[model samples]
Target chain A: MTLASPLAALGRPVLAALAALGRVAIYAGQTFGALFSKPFYTREFLSSLLHVGWLSLPVVGLTAIFTGGALALQIYAGGQRFSAEAVVPQIVAIGMVRELGPVLVGLMIAARVTSSIAAEIATMKVTEQIDALVTLSTNPLKYLTLPRVLAGTLTVPLLVAVGDIIGIMGGFLVATGQLGFNKATYIQNTLDFLEGADVVSSLVKGAVFGFIATLIGCYHGMASGRGAMGVGGATKTAVAAASVLILAANFLLTSVMFGS
Target chain B: MIELANVTKSFGSNHVLRGVNLIVPKGQSMVVIGGSGTGKSVLLKCVLGLVRPDQGLITLDGQDVAKAEREAFLARFGMLFQGGALFDSLKVWENVAFRLLRGPLKRPKAEARAIAIEKLRRVGLVPETADLFPAELSGGMQKRVGLARAIAAEPEIIFFDEPTTGLDPIMAGVINDLIREIVSEMGATAITITHDMTSVRAIADRVAMLHGGVIRWTGPVKEMDVTSDPYVQQFIHGRATGPIAAVR
Candidate 1:
């Protein structure tokens, strides 16, 4: 085999990936430009808010509550190794607000909202509804993508805020009812341990992660191939990409906010 | 009038269209006949500016289509997809009234609904059908809804892409007759792409046969039967052997 063959093989996928990224950037720019234009489609925007925000509450609440309970138990156990059991309330507050709250909400949205948006749009594309929109003098980006993206961007942070509160409440309930800690002391420790910066960073992460998830969903759906398999593949890729990007964005935002 | 001169398009190694030339005069129906994957749909999409030609001139009434204002350019045309491209999220009336409810054509909600119901009636659908989703309808009913939606804005030009596909013969004939009647009534310039000779005879004032990425033959529909062009003859007669292959 030629020495250049391996290098060429490696370069091919790298180039393809770069091209895909370029397409995604262009798509994002177009959606952003279309965001402020006239013909706002307010009905679609409200519907999207209901879909991406209101409907997502149940799953978000359940996930947050369970994670918080487990997290409190884990922190209690870990603190025992250092004879630092008293730190449970403080650590759970910081952990849920600064990390678990936003990340878990983001991932849940990736699984729930991202996959749903991708599948629905991809099916519309395969069935020519997008083309129909174009023929009707409607820009699909404005009619479809912008509303969902805006909903995700605006609502995910609120969802995360809710998650953080619920998560802290779950920890408080566990620490008081099960761990023999007084309720009032637990609440005070959690409140005093959480700073405005930590809460702000968590919400910021939520917004960024929301944008990534919905945008990825729309992009994949718009670029999907033809038929059922294409819709399936788009859903799979959107969820996977959104999840990874949310985690990566979380890390980057964390470093920026807390780095030395 | 709409005209395409020396149009060409390719996707990867597939040269779907090469140097196609044709014209459709205003107020006449033109049916383009070709087998599956012979680029009939691509050619229709080209005229709608949904697909750009690699090299060609497409003009609508002496203005270059490529340079026309997109909203205005698309405003003049309506299309019925092979599959009824109705928005599943919307009711039948909402799908029909989609163009009226937004953009420059915006109408009051009640007026749009009234127009939608009228258009639905024009296509022989019951007023009750207006409140239902497309999924609730049968295949034939969905096609009628698509037809109603296509003509909702009363566009100057209309396109039918395989309008008779995926229907029983009776339903197919019903759709063809409805299309013919609608085109005549609206006096809208119409272009249809299909392999069904029945549809061609029923709908076309003029006919063009596309094969091998080009227009092999075109003439008035009455002359199509007598045309000796091998490809046209083979296609019209549904022959097994001809200049066109049975397999790609």
Candidate 2:
């Protein structure tokens, strides 16, 4: 039955998007359930941790350092107009811990880990390795999705914490060298300005972004269509979805944690 | 024994399985042959509980497989996929012993590796091949590794999906002979889905022809040549024009 209504033109794609969202939510729920279930694949978990966490450090660290340095320079220029140059240390600390650190780490993960995970698992599905896992009496969700999700959720926070430190240090280096701030005074102000809640919020944002990135990767991989184009499309969609969701999640988390 | 009664499955506008009914008896090799997209693989998956049928019943040894305890039910079956589908991340031995190293079939690490090596040898691969990854092997070698993985647990029921697809004639012949010998030696019930007549002749104790989602014919292999059904006749003789309607 064809509808004469103009809304019909927009109906199918919107419905498909909603349906895809529904499937991802269900998949996420099942993965969470699998987390507590038996036959937990420790071997898969550790290997995934190594891949999604340890291997991702260099990219996240490099992104953070550069971003922090750039942020300090921009803030310094803007501060000059208002004669607020004395606020560099405090501003840099707050910026790194509260916003740039988690967001940058999350986006880096979306670029590095999400695409790789999606490509690897989508290839596995294409080759029937996933079906083979089923025949071998192994739950693919338990063996594949849960470990990657757990590793991402647990490790990205730590990555964010490390990134926060490195980013703040980058700002300090730039401020002390180019901006002529006193090293001792900058360090003291940075330490004095950062509260425990700031650290907590950064770690919490990291954890949430990590979950979003990894879960989207696994979801796209599992729900991929058939053949090479299917896998390629899935890999692309995973990164895009992870990036967008990381930003959206960051906004939601920020509002809840700091808006009040 | 496995049975599918009035099973039906469809994907949107496509009707893949339509009221299909068939029975595979114990301790015998049953091969189902059909053109591409005839739902042979879907039927196989339905029995394995990989794809749930939209309607009808599938039973293994008279018990519904869908309702059986998943781990115990799957432990009884092994399947060799169309492609080798070996885990590229792991060594060949690790792929072979994947089942043995985890879940209900868990074995000690050394024991699993040893058994994997033994199974590899049984499929004509040397112990040296065990350390290489699947990507390092030729297509034929990867298929042999898949065969090794299939039999690693010595499952009571084995399903081979297009076992000889994508192989040269010589390699296909070798795989067919190996399958016949191994299945006979293991005394396991086997179901192989393939359009390769050579494989059917070499492996099937019984033949079932599937077309339009139902069994068009079923009988002993000796009578496959004599089957009067037009679909069976066309498929066996490789005819483009028949009741099977290739383009439609």
The best candidate by lDDT is 1
Give the worst 10-residue stretch by lDDT in candidate 1 chain A: A33-42
CA displacement after TM-score superposition, residue A174 of candidate 2 (Å): 1.3
- Error at A93, model 1, angstroms: 1.0
The Cα RMSD in angstroms, rounded to one decimal, for candidate 1 relative to the true structure is 0.9
Worst lDDT 10-window in candidate 1 chain B: B239-248
Error of 2 at A123 (Å): 1.2
Error of 1 at A236 (Å): 0.8
DockQ of candidate 2 against the true complex? 0.91
Report the C-alpha lDDT of model 2 over A46-142, residue by residue, as the tens digit.
Answer: 9989998999999888988888888889889999999998898899889999999999999999999999999989999988999999999988899
Model 1: per-residue Cα lDDT at residue A55: 97
Q: In candidate 1, residue A48 scores what lDDT?
A: 93
What global local distance difference test value does model 1 have? 0.94
